[model samples]
Target: MKRSLGTQLRHLIELLDGAVGAAYEEAGLTYRPRYTPVMRALMQNEPATIGHIATAAGITQPAATQTIALMVKQGLVTTEAGVPDGRQKLIRLSPQGRELLPKLQQCWQATAAAAASLEAECALSSTIEAAIEALAARPYGERIRAARAVMVDSGKS
Candidate 1:
């Protein structure tokens, strides 16, 4: 039996995230890998809107919002209503978060080195990038719907 592509992708994430989580734990840092993109975005710019963070992090706005909420609860970030637009929220790193930045940046550097080592051993990064580009042109949902039509037409569904 062979694993499905989705299963393989998920397993890969689990393996990588688990190891990274362990590294953070050993470093005595309380952090989540999901927070990395948000942190990076905020580090680059303060008083950022959710949309800005989303674009900077290459993540959806909902994900950025959720991560920001969690970070706020952990006292890692502060959010306030935008001065120009009361409805829009601006986010910035809290003092605690800034204090942790140096250590987090070091961990990120180490993680990148480890990831590069893995990339040297495998074509993982390039393949994922290509897949992302291909999917951007024709999304997976569209592909699935086309395949489903074929299955229905052939009475294979």
Candidate 2:
């Protein structure tokens, strides 16, 4: 029998990240797998606020903030208050981060190629895309709640 959906998805992430993280370490890069989206956002739009970063990265503002904070600690990025609204933090890549871009870009290209090959072999890219679209239309939480209601009404809960 197959494991739970969430568990399987999480395990997949662990496996993928483990391999990707190893690659980063082998390259002598102090980057984390979780930081890719934020880094890409910053690469394209430097000196951007946390809100903008969050939007570009398709992640929550809090997650962007935490990632930025970690990057700052690692001397990979810097943060300053935004103009007009000093409360907003604007993030920029540090000199060290800038220096690592070429190598990171190479790594990114390799990773992309590997992912494309894996998708071609597995044929799951479309399925995953559709799943994302479906969930966007109706969240998993809503489905779960509806199922639970059915079970309760049927005296099976």
Candidate 3:
């Protein structure tokens, strides 16, 4: 049986992430590759709201919220009520998270170099950027819905 495109894409992501995660382990860092974006966001935009971090990381609000919760649990960050808005919570890295930054920075650079090498080998970055642009113009979900409608109509006919 042939694997779907989504499955293949996820497999590729997992492969790449595993390599990076291994590198982090080698460096004695207990970091998940997925946490990089949120950590970087906190470094550059401390005192940011969940919305800000999500946008800065180009991730969904729920994803950012979940990551933040895990970070808090791991003592990587702390959240408090927003200065002016009691409803909004501001997030920032903890002292431990700040201390981990130096190592994280090294790992980030190494991981970037590794990803660049991979991209050079296959031009994967450009291909992915192009795919994202195409999807922005015409979302996959909309295309799928249209195709399903056509299939249903044809079956009826």
Better of 1 and 2 by TM-score: 1
| Candidate 3 backbone collisions, by pair | none
Candidate 1's displacement at residue 105, Å, is 1.0
Candidate 1 clashes: the total is 0
lDDT (Cα, 0-100) at 34 in candidate 1: 92
Taking every candidate in turn, the Cα RMSD to the unseen true structure, in Å, is 1.5, 1.5, 1.3
Q: Candidate 1 on 99-131: residue-level lDDT in tens?
A: 999989889999999999999999789999999
lDDT of 2 by residue, 15-112 (tens): 89998989899898878988889889999998999999999999999999899889899998998888897988889999988898898988899889
Instruction: Report the lDDT tens digits of candidate 3 across residue range 1-157.
Output: 9999999999999999999899989999887887888999988988999999999999999999999999999898999999765899999999999999999999989888988889889999999999999999999999999999999999999
The best candidate in terms of lDDT: 1
What C-alpha lDDT values do all the predictions have? 0.94, 0.90, 0.92
* TM, every model: 0.96, 0.95, 0.94
Cα displacement (Å) at residue 36, model 3: 0.8
- Report the C-alpha displacement of residue 114, candidate 2, in angstroms: 0.8
Candidate 3 has a TM-score of 0.94
Q: Judge candidate 1 at residue 150 and give its lDDT.
A: 92
Query: Which of 1 and 3 is the better model by TM-score?
Result: 1
Q: Which stretches of candidate 1 lie over 4 Å from their true place?
A: none
